[model samples]
Target: MQVFVTGTAGFIGYHLARRLLEDGHVVTGFDGVTDYYDVSLKRSRLAALQQYPQFSAIEGRLEDAGLLSETLERAQAEIVVHLAAQAGVRYSIEQPQSYISANLVGTANLLEAVRAHKPRHLLMASTSSVYGGNTKLPFSERDAADAPISLYAATKKSNEVMAHSYAHLFDIPTTMLRFFTVYGPWGRPDMALFKFVSAILAGQPIEIFGEGKMRRDFTFVDDLIEAMIRIMPLRPELGQPLQGDSLSAVAPYRVVNLAGGHPELLMDFVAAIETALGHKAAYTIKPMQAGDPRETAADTALLRELVGDLPRTPIKAGVASFVAWYRQYYRV
Candidate 1:
């Protein structure tokens, strides 16, 4: 299958594109490679994908609707995975306009491109942050996720609704994946795990949010990728919602959580990193930052129903793999 993937320079996008190429699928990667964190890291990821003969990439912004449309037409993609966006909660608070342009307008353009092209399967990313103000122990697909504390989460939530509208109107098969705190090798620099690892390796103080009381359903990137691979072919049908599924009754669209279904404390996660690096990290506990959640736990019962088994990468092992990659990547 020929796949059109956005954000190929990103951490998840890089890994996903590589896996698709390995599986003998032709991938047309698209990324702007903005200097959101480190452009060098993005270039390195793109370089890795360039090694594959079946992989090709485009350097452009999603805000360029004409380019996106032309690229989609040229690729003639059977499947489309939209992963490019302005990510980061605190960053969203700081640069709310960036989120508006990338997450909102950019997503709107992508949806228009996909709607015009009409791929067999359209899988875009959402976030667990949408489950804001829902103090439930484990969040379920059946739960209402109307409240979003951060602009980033709000934009993602808007993406879900906007995609549903397109799915219903255009009869497109769409799946919005609500990802938990995903981390592993080739992780984003702005993520907590990467920040912690960098600080620990440099013997710098690692800032702890919520006074180290936050817990997250930290899903490993490999596990999340595997789930996506298995789900790519499982497109939803109209008026055929599964039992307890988040599938829309009106459209052939559903919102699924890609999570480990296990919540680990922030300190426990730091401990896993410490154990992996064989070094103690200096901690600076502080109040929770805006647009950040206190705790996140996924009720992946519907995910299990869809994919049979859940991703079970332990925190320690995932952290260890990331640490090894970090050491090799930075020679630290």
Candidate 2:
């Protein structure tokens, strides 16, 4: 299989691209190596992927439409997974224009490239944050996701509709994956787990947002990759919806939640980190930040129907694995 994956230097993209390469598939990765967090970390991930002979990488921003189109044309990818975007909920509040440039414009360019190349299957990343301001537990893909609290979520929601339009007009089969809180080895530094572990190890106080009252459906990175691998082949067909499907009536487009379907409290997650690090963390309880949700839960009926019996890694084990990796990587 020939796959073109954007955000290859990112956490989820790195895992997905590595898995594909290990399976002996030809993977052409694209990344801008932005300094959103740490450029060194992104460079390390790209270096790891470069070790694989089957893996090739292109260093360019998604905003560069000509480069993206030309690369897609040369790769001639059978499958295209769009994952690159300016990610960070609170950061989006600080730099809203970055979101517009990366999430909105970047995705629009990728869709155009895909429209021209016409891949067999197109999988784009969405977010559970799109189910904003809705007090519904276990969010379903069939539910309305029109109200997004943060600019980041709003951009992702825009991507979904944008892809739908292209799918309808260009006859592209597209699947939009709404991911919950994804964390594991080689995770992003801005994420909760990494911050908690780092603070605890350095004997610094960690800040617990929402006064430790928020809940999240945490999905391990490996589980997310597994679900994605299974979903890559199952393209949506019009009028062929499955039970509890989010398949579109007009286009070969569908939205599915990729998560463990289990919600855990913020305090419990912190406890797991403490257990993994063998050090109790000194933390201060703080009010929830703007545009942040009190809780997020995903209804995975559609996911299970599509990919049966996925591996759900326990929080303690997952945190432990990340701690181990963090210690080794940072030499802490």
Candidate 3:
């Protein structure tokens, strides 16, 4: 199979591309290698992918419509996975237009390119943040996702609806994955786990926002990739949905959560890092930050139905894997 993947320089994208190459698939990866974080980390991810003969990559932003369309047509991809975007909740508050340009305009161009050259199965990344301001215990895909508190979430929500329209009109089999708080080796520096680990290693006090009371459904990167591969073959059809399904009645599209159903407390996550690195973290508690939900839990019934039972790596073990990778990568 030939797979076209975006954001190949990113953590999730790098891991997924490697897995596909290992599975003997030819993967054409695209990434802008933006300076949103350390470019060295992004370069390292690209370097790892470059080692695989079956993997090739192009450096370009999603906003570059002609480049994206040209790359997609050149790959002749059977499986198209769109993962590139400007990601950050608080950062979205500061730079809303970036989200609009990347998530909105970039995605629109991708859809148009897909419309021109239809793939067998099209999978794109959404976020669990779309269920914003919903007090539902476990956010379900069937629930209304109309109210997005942040520009980032709003853009993703728009992507879902926009994709649904394309799927309906073009008869393209599409699946939108609403990822939870994903964490693992080669994690992004802006993410909480990376910050905690980096701060602890530097003998600096880690900032605990929301007074260490926030909760998140942390999905391991490996498990998320596993789910994606499994679900790739199970493309949605324009038909009646099964129980607990988020399939659209009007389109050959559905939204699935790529996460464990359980949500862990912020402090518990901190404790896991402590257990992993064997260092007690000094904390500076702070009030809840803007553009963040107090807690996010996923209802992954649809996911389990589509992809069987998830790997559900425990927070402690996941943290240990990340810590080891961080130490080895940075020689800390």
Question: How many steric overlaps does candidate 2 have?
Answer: 0
TM-score of 3: 0.99
Error of 2 at 326 (Å): 0.1
Better of 1 and 2 by lDDT: 2
* Model 2 TM-score relative to the real fold: 0.99
Residue pairs in candidate 3 whose N, alpha carbon or C atoms collide under 3 angstroms: none
User: Largest lDDT belongs to which candidate?
Assistant: 2
lDDT of each: 0.93, 0.95, 0.93
- Residue-level lDDT of model 1, residues 112-225, one tens digit each, is 999899899999999999998799879997798999999999999999999999999999999999999989999999999999999988889999989999999999999999
Better of 2 and 3 by TM-score: 2
Per-candidate clashes come to 0, 0, 0
What are the C-alpha RMSDs, in order, of all predicted structures? 0.8, 0.5, 0.8
Model 2: per-residue lDDT, tens digit, 1-332? Answer: 99999999999999999999999999999999999999999999999999999899999999999999999999999999999999999999999999999999999999999999999999999999999988878899988998899999999999999999999999999999999999999999999999999889999999999989999999999999999999999999999999999999999999999999999999999999989999999999999999999999999999999989999999999999999999999999
lDDT score of residue 202 within candidate 3: 96
lDDT of 2 at 173: 100
